[model samples]
Target chain A: MTPSTDSPPRIYTAALAIIGNEILSGRTQDANLNHLAKTLNGWGVEMREARVVPDIESEIVAAINALRARYDYVFTTGGIGPTHDDITADSIAKAFGLPLVEHPAAIALLEHYYPPGELTVVRRRMARVPEGADLIENPISKAPGFKIENVFVLAGVPSIMRAQLQGARAFIAGGRSVLSRTVSVLVGESKIAELLETAQGQFPDVDMGSYPFFKRNALGTALVLRGREEARLEAAYDVLVGALSAAGIEGHPGELPD
Target chain B: MTPSTDSPPRIYTAALAIIGNEILSGRTQDANLNHLAKTLNGWGVEMREARVVPDIESEIVAAINALRARYDYVFTTGGIGPTHDDITADSIAKAFGLPLVEHPAAIALLEHYYPPGELTVVRRRMARVPEGADLIENPISKAPGFKIENVFVLAGVPSIMRAQLQGARAFIAGGRSVLSRTVSVLVGESKIAELLETAQGQFPDVDMGSYPFFKRNALGTALVLRGREEARLEAAYDVLVGALSAAGIEGHPGELPD
Candidate 1:
């Protein structure tokens, strides 16, 4: 991708819909959202929002519809297994008004994985995909995830989800990547709230955030600036560092607040 | 909380809005949602949904309004700090049409925590609360969280958040708590997909879920049944186990899917 010199760089935003009763019920702590967010960031895509919904079909349908409409890409994790409760593929089909068809490629993969006599009805469920969807290759498991429209359906297991994401990333079109810088202030965030707000106003395009952290007996804040333009981000970082020095607070580079 | 005998016992639902750029940026993994969900479940409240939004005011306002309107109770974490980026309190006030005021109790707590010369302008920011809101005590830190209408605003720090939650729990009136039982079958979830669906159909009121897991190169599924009625939940669990046994798969109790 060529870097654009347009006044405002192109911005690509994505959203995640985590579908699982296991997550909502607190039985399983979700590890996919963070992984996806970091991965997407590296690929020049911003994950703007994320929602964790139950395994219910209607809930999954609603979230997919809303997110796919609002964001450039919508990636859904969980609820794609071969169980009665695994309803993500069917829900995505319903959301897009497509038929749930058994994909030939997926069936072939499953057929090859399981013995000729072992391809039961339950195993066949894994081969079903939304009509006209492209298969997302899964190296760890033979059952493939599929992408329909702008929604990518991946397995819930962390390992499978990461692998599926790597495959899906190759097909995605990314915009200008976001550049970030974190400056750790040796004082509580409250002490520098006003200065941070002033700096944010000066750099309206850059998203500035102050996170307070406490570790051992020390308290500090990490001032993070994120923007699509590297030059603008560095300028904003300079402004933040200068403001901290003016307030008689020492700012350290690359030192994250606990 | 009373155990009710009424068929299809009352179910209380809640939604959480996690407000912070740290979480969205993947700089911080939110620890509040799972803790709150587990805690609320013990209080007979089911946390149905959760949304993670950035520190932007408009996003926070929109999420708070939507969640508060849909669920029985709405709990928000993060962004209620003493920083310029800590806009959760103001955004929440805007959402409910409440005036931002210096809460007397909050101010007193700050005053008591800081010495005569230590209460700076930034520190006093924590004293602001929505008008007519009741203070949710913060035992770890002096600054207090508050409750306005159906929404509860807590400190973003995990320790302070947990303490504030403990104080706020007493004011909530709980309905019938959900009873859950998990049966682990030493077979793939797809192997028994049809049976699970049929059992789910039989117990329509119970929230049935099947989670697939992989451990030590072995794959299995956990069948979970949740409902407000213990007898009904037990009945559903029995049905699931019986179905597994009929399918020649042994169902183990309390054995979690990996």
Candidate 2:
């Protein structure tokens, strides 16, 4: 075999579509976006963006279509239940220009879980998926979520969404995992803004951010460094810490408690 | 003056753009979206959509432009601090094709807040805003947020953002407030899905949603009815409760505890 030259690592990106009126209406605080972001980051997939849209069909279709075309993966949560407002399946089908059909496997799963003849018409609505879609197992509830192309439709409930995401892991082809390190100091962010800007200029490849926090009646800042390369991140962190030391501020290794 | 006809009330809509890499990176769970949504709802401005974008200027500009054009008002939280990562003001300027300029009022506020000679060049960045923008006062910190056209820019910190939003309230023109009523029943959503659908069909003006919950080792569903008219929402709620009673299910007045 011939030796191949090294090339840059590919990046995998994902976007989330939170489909629910409860979230947009402030009736429910979405707990899924953060979980999905951290989980995808651990799997080496960067969560680039997220949209919280109401339960309306046109809105869901627009968000799904836009996100799916722009990223490697698109995950949708909410509006997959058996209620009348559960229109995500129909919206996804419309977005893909596909037909909505009842998946036999999903029907079978519901059949096995519920008592005989207990799956009413409304309950059977959970078995519907877009044509040419595959099922993403939901261990929490017998009714399964479906995957159509790059979009994975999961239950709105956090626990079921997390479990179905595990079922989705095998399908995702992750790239290089982005590593992050945080340095904290008991000083306002303005005090270290100049130093961070200089360090950021020095390490152009590393992404740096300064987040301020107020704890115990004192203000502090947490400086985070993120990159695909560990050594580069460490070098930037060392430079930042050295600069803080020169400025007579003690930089800690991790963030302070909120 | 001539008497006016009893026409339908207008609906005021708004969108939010969350500008921060920390939010997309899952390092911080966003505490502003819920508060903003709830506050806007109480002000009779419906929060129709929200987008969470990273600190990239192009992304921020794109989200702001899209949201500002589509909604009556647009609000953004984050990236407006004294740090180098604070690029929201510049991004908003670019979004509007307006020149970024240091506002004299903002500079005065910062100058008065900080001690003499304590407002460094980096801290002075907080005074920079797009040309032809009004300042939104931040009571917690003197660094003011800005309102450019239909867009209101606020701080990323929850406390500061909340205070700034209050300052922006005077500029808002609110429509009729949306009123909501919830009824809870100890049954899976599927059990009442058909009845809820029937109720929704009867009262087309009222928006209905069913949210499933699991508490104390039992399953329940909360059916929420929302509309601009109080009497219409109450009528829908009563019909839904009557349906549940007819089915021999005792429906509670409000949602179950999570």
Q: Which candidate is the best by DockQ?
A: 2
Residue B138 miss distance in model 2 (angstroms): 2.1
Evaluate all candidate structures by whole-model CA lDDT and list the values in order.
0.85, 0.91
Cα lDDT tens digits for candidate 2, B1-258:
212246777899999999999999999999898999999999999999999999999999999999999999999999999888999999999999999999999888988888999988988899999999999976666667899999999999898899999999989999888899999999999899988999999999899999998887898999999998887788889999999999988998887776
Q: Candidate 1 has what TM-score? A: 0.94
Give the TM-scores of the predictions, in the order they appear.
Answer: 0.94, 0.97
> Which tens-of-lDDT digit does each residue in A106-182 have in candidate 2?
89998888899998888889999999999997665565788999999999989889999988887899988899999
lDDT of 1 by residue, B167-208 (tens): 898778778677789988778877888999999999988888
True contacts kept of each: 0.74, 0.83
Q: State how far residue B190 of model 2 sits from its true place (Å).
A: 0.8
| Poorly placed runs, candidate 1 (over 4 Å) | A1-5, A256-258, B1-7, B256-258
